[model samples]
Target: MAGAGSWFVEQPPAEPPAEASASFERLYRAFLSARAALGLALVMAQLISVVLGTTPARSTLALSLSYAVAALALWLAPQLRRGASARSLARISSPHWWSAIGVDLILFGVLHALDPSGVNYGALFVMPVLMAAVLSPRMLALATAAMATLGLLGAAAWSLLAGLDVGLKTTQAGLVGSGLFAVSLLAGELSARLAREEKAARGSLALARQQELLNRLVIDEMQEGVLVVDRRGRIRAMNPAARSLLGAASGELSWQLRGRADWQPLVLALERAYGGSAGEGGAEVDVALALDSGAARSLRLRLRFTRQREGSEELCVLFVEDNRELLARTRQEKLAAMGRVSAGIAHEIRNPLAAIAQANALLAEDVAGGRAEQLTRMVASNVQRLKRLVDDVSELAPGMQPDTQPLDVSALVQETCEDWVQVNGVEPGAQSRFRLHIGAPGLTGLFDAEHLRRILVNLLDNAHRHAEPGAGAIQATLDRHGDALDLVVRSAGAPVPHEIERHLFEPFFSTRSRGSGLGLYICRELCERHGARIDYRRATDAAANEFCVRLRTPSSASSA
Candidate 1:
């Protein structure tokens, strides 16, 4: 059992996972930032060219208008980052990239036709750089090489056909420009591939680390001792939990028994229970073992076999769960027979003791001795105590069957809480900090309403008595567990001790001063009558200890 330490409180939502809007917003912002930087640089370059005395007014205006259009294109970049549609990337990058290049090409043609020798058109590298910025490196490299060749051919043809006196070897200049563009394209492709590969490698490394961490967590935190053995029963894998249970160290699989032996009796007992039926399908078996410490223990073990090859033998995986607690309870039933016999003998003696007390009361009235009066009082008190003990023992017997019908469990819980609030005299205006979590619709099921109410009322009363002083709050929640319903009531208080938890449902046992010791015992009896079970265990993961009631609906027998 967990110790009596207060933990922090948090109310988690009862809902499924939904699509994440924050991740989409982050991707959108990244796209906009990249596009904005490119558009701003282009606009600044156009302004600088116009401020200098090298470009004509009409050309300056055309560049300014093109920059304005490119600025507008930046707003649409976020849509391009969306990968849900198959053709989204192509539609976003290809249209805008080609449009910017087409505008630049038209402007270059117009300037050469107007004044062929004066325009310093080498700055046209900006168009290809913009293409590289918008699309991936591979597409940008191919587009740049094609655009450079076309520009060279168009310039040389125009110089001859339009009669412009541009005296130069146009093919040589074209070759030089195309060579520079090719070098830039190669550099971009290599850098992009390197970045992509590095990113993929990092992702894979992180994933591997995550899986390793998960494996260690499972090995350390699991309660069931897990062992993986080959067909020959040689130990292949054993987690830390298994090692601790088996009393083995890092490297010793075969060792002679000393004061502690974990292998022989436990394993042999399970095998014997299987009765040689451990070939293929999974089988569960229970075994009793006498440990070296003179304590007999029972374990519930499950074995599963998986064949490594078609012809090869199978490997058996064993899961051993400790069932010492249940075994102890089974033994306690024998010890309780003494109490049952004592109570029965007390009942047989009670009638004669009652007659003696009545006769003594009459004799005391006649004779007036104070000693007789004191003796009479003592005899009456002892008789009453014995009668009470016998009554407590009798309540342990099984009772009436459940009268079940379908009921709205949430509404019933709400009504119960409201009635409690009223009974406690809490004002309607006062703030109630208690949280109520009711599961969704169709949580209704057939159950005995009166019996369930009695169980809840008893649990609530028990919580109210044991709750901590300052944090006078209780939370009630309803949950659907497969086809059954679960009711949980939590209050701020110390956890019930382990010794108390073991006999919590046993009749005539309690921790209170004036309690009948039958509150929880009766609750369990009622729950069992309705085809359900009530149990008490410490809530190690909450701000306070919680007592949960699991109510399984009864399966109806068909009417013949």
Candidate 2:
């Protein structure tokens, strides 16, 4: 009995272990059901005995009815304890050998002791033994089997004292005890093995879920677009980059690829991959999508397939990249390399340029008013142009921060326009080719004064080159736009061609044979450094070509 007491000793955990608690509750409920059924069977057996005229004792009938009622109460306990804490529920639901097994042992032992019709009640002991084996610890299970063995032997010894066949009864009791012991050990080991497998399965499921979330996060943040599509042209999944590249709305996640005209190229690429035109590794294709904006966007697509195993559908993974962006990135890399080389070349040219300027100045002094004087002047002008070119190229090198300060934009624009007109020899007054209009006085902006001057000079020069020689052929206006200032230089001319407009600010792109092509590029670069923007458009109201520079005001810069 002391060994049997070990079955009831359980330490309540602070927090119930999920897997262990669930497993115990499940097994506990199943055994409770078994106990209830057994109790009913015992009551039915007693009633049948009475109907057959082999009436059992009144005490036996009372014991069977009591067991049935006890079993029913235990089975219904879990439903009454709902919403309880884990520790509380665990205590109520945990399978203890005493709850089911101990009750069954006492009932069977009493029934065996009070045998009325000489029925063998020893077989009933197997129920408690088997229940203990499956639900209790190994030592507890063995202890339970030993207790049942003692009960059987005691019954056999009592029968011998009553002059029954003692030898036969003792041998049967010994054999039954041996079988019970074996069942207990074997069942306990199998139960432990099952628990281990269940725990491993739970860990694997948790790990797989974590990995899935991490993969989704990584894909969403990727710069390149990623799409997962099945063979049926259905877009199963797509990351944010993919949605942006496809111009698809965020909520249009599950749409078919073939539903839209712009998506036909993707459908064809998917078909090619599935139709085996794509290699085992994957395929790459260039596609053009005509968007709602009436513009054709180019994309480079690489399609790869998941390994097609039996019983699983094959999926295609499409990696999409905007071809224009790819080209821009490649161009930037090339430009970076070119900048390094150009910086070196500009440095080497500086010494020679200085020597050439010195020689030109010395030579100009010796010349009189003749072709020699004109030649020296041209040499000096050309040298100045070379120096300007070198300066523009050097500006392209990395790590040049703008030295910005608050300045009067109105005064700068007026001064720059006046100086440009004088330098380019434009006549002032009613018939002046260049007209300057200052809309507001004391309009201050944040800018590098030198950079702003260079930007204005470049824009004025471009306007001068394109403007017809007449009154107001070019107009430079400064005005306020929101919290910023806009300096618009409009020149009377036909609008720039669309083909050339796209590359208007690109480096080394010029229509003239001798044009260095860095004027607008350097202007754009300078504007960007000063946190401003410059763009070109045909002014519809003025019916002229306009280059507008939007300068950041001090207040706007401060707020930003």
Best-performing candidate as measured by lDDT: 2
Clash pairs, candidate 1, are none
lDDT of each: 0.58, 0.82
Encode model 1's per-residue lDDT on 1-560: one tens digit a residue: 11111010010221111212342234334544554564566566656775885454665455545555654564565454344211222232545434434444455444444443355454454454434422333444455545655665566667778775445637544764676466556555554454455446656887899999998788668877777665444676777666655556877553332324546765564355345756657678776656545666577767877755878766666777668754667766754674567556766776876787688677667756588778767776766665655554554433335677777777787778788767765444334535567887556756677667766777877777877654335667789886578898887777887877788887668787667677787687766666676666566766576778876643332221
For TM-score, the strongest prediction is 2
- Lowest summed lDDT over 10 consecutive residues: which window, candidate 1? 2-11
lDDT of 2 by residue, 9-40 (tens): 23222222665567666776787798889889
Q: What is candidate 2's CA lDDT for residue 198?
A: 57
TM-scores, all candidates, are 0.33, 0.77
lDDT of 1: 0.58
